[model samples]
Target: MLTDRTDTRAKLWRTASVQRGYFTAAQAKDAGYSYQAQRYHTQHGNWLQVDRAIYRFREFVDLPAEGDEQLVRWSLWSKGRAAVSHATALTMHDLGTASPSRIHMTVPRNFRQQTDALILHRAELTEGDVEERVGYRVTTPLRALVECAAVGEDQNALDIAIAKALSQGLVTQPKLLYAAQQVGPRAELGVERALAAAS
Candidate 1:
């Protein structure tokens, strides 16, 4: 019986080592560790809990190195309503020079979170608001620029986003004007300028 238990532990360790950093409880269970065994492994220093049902190996692994930490965090934070946007969307579009302090995502009206790292906004997003970019589902560059123009209090940021979209030829003048009209007068100049440049 002791040998059998040891074999299970060894198997779990080998499965975890290959993953290197993180695994969910479901994943651990799928890898052959029973719930009680998984708990025992945690108590014995084999796994560390990062969040509810999320586990990582005991040794520290580089979260940034994997390039999917944000995805993992997003998955944990309710994947349905969250879509990367604003300056983070700019970064994803490779159109601007700003580094957003936190992951900028928009959630539905009812979503909430405990951390400030997630800037949750209550908004309605349709299929039109989302697009595939660099293999990830994100707000389209044109849509994100318009969104920034509409909601961003910083005129400079709005101008930059509009300019970038225009310079890249992603939005035409008529479309820009139409979008600005939808947002109101505050966004008119930036949208007009972007449209002119795109023409």
Candidate 2:
């Protein structure tokens, strides 16, 4: 029989548990932990500081795998305003053999976070362009393919990503074409080549 306060703590722990036991300072505040309380937890070794603004509960115990560490940390860094995008989104959607060394994220044009571990693309994302995966937000497969082809310099990689998306029925050629058209001339050439190869 847990008391009300204990139940609140447990609820917060459960929320962070899904995200590799990681939570942001904002989340702590929302869960009724004051700034002083957060510091107290850190000082007492009850919570581990994972990044500049991210903390992990000592007992939450849901560690991320090797490849997911960077993505998870950067996701926390975004504080939910960014969605995984471009090559990283392609990898998340399993649409290509892309192994991006840096995490790619799409933030609104006014987003202001500056970090070295992430490549930021400023875009106005609509609801249809993003999806939640596990506890992270990512661009949809169709949007990811268009983004990869639009900005990616490597034609070979774009070809493979586009082909994978089409073969897997993740997106159709018209969807790619529409997305590319939305980007206008910046994406025309890549989308043309990708369409040819995928079709």
Candidate 3:
């Protein structure tokens, strides 16, 4: 009969904390709380709604305190259909000086998420484009740079990314050239120059 009220409350707290300040209504239902109980918790200041169907711990609700919220937001966005990219990826790779104000993520063209914290775009990626970081999947440094070069307006950023990737030995000159070719004219000159330097 699920009559252990104390045990249920403890489980809810543990579940919410484990998710790092985020919970969904569906998760609450699965955890044996009614929709009304979920609302009651929110109204009582035990939980705070961070987004539609997303709740967070009232004490740690600041979205920009660190990159963790961005990761969580990305995970909740589009069935986790997002991967870090652009300046964010450059930061992760330690390949640039720019600190993006928002988390950059790539999703399919048809996917949508209801948040402004993410700079979302559409692109296709292969398995080689992704890497695992901090237990979360993200675009590899090389692939992210190429993606940035392919779409970004600034060529110098792409040049720096290429140089950084080469300096780190994270990618070979030939591979960079191939990726540049794939992205077309936007990246061709940068890739060619980087390749020449590497050779």
lDDT of candidate 2 over 88-111, digit per residue (tens) = 888888875857887889999999
Residue 80 displacement (Å), model 1: 3.5
Candidate 3 achieves a global lDDT of: 0.71
Error of 2 at 112 (Å): 1.3
Candidate that scores best on TM-score: 2
TM-scores of the models, in the order given: 0.66, 0.88, 0.79
Give stretches of model 2 more than 4 Å off. 1-5, 60-69
Task: Give the Cα RMSD of candidate 1.
Answer: 5.2
Single out the weakest 10-residue window by summed lDDT for candidate 2.
Answer: 60-69
Model 1 lDDT tens row, 73-168: 464446345788766777777765676777777777787665666766557778988875322356777767766666643566656666766777
lDDT of each: 0.65, 0.81, 0.71
Arrange candidates by TM-score, descending.
Answer: 2, 3, 1
Candidate 1 global lDDT = 0.65
Residue 133 local lDDT, model 3: 53
Model 2, residue 65: C-alpha shift (Å)? 2.5
Best of the candidates, lDDT: 2
Comparing 2 and 3 on TM-score, the stronger one = 2
Model 1 spans with C-alpha error above 4 angstroms: 1-48, 56-68, 132-136, 183-190, 193-199
Error of 3 at 140 (Å): 0.8
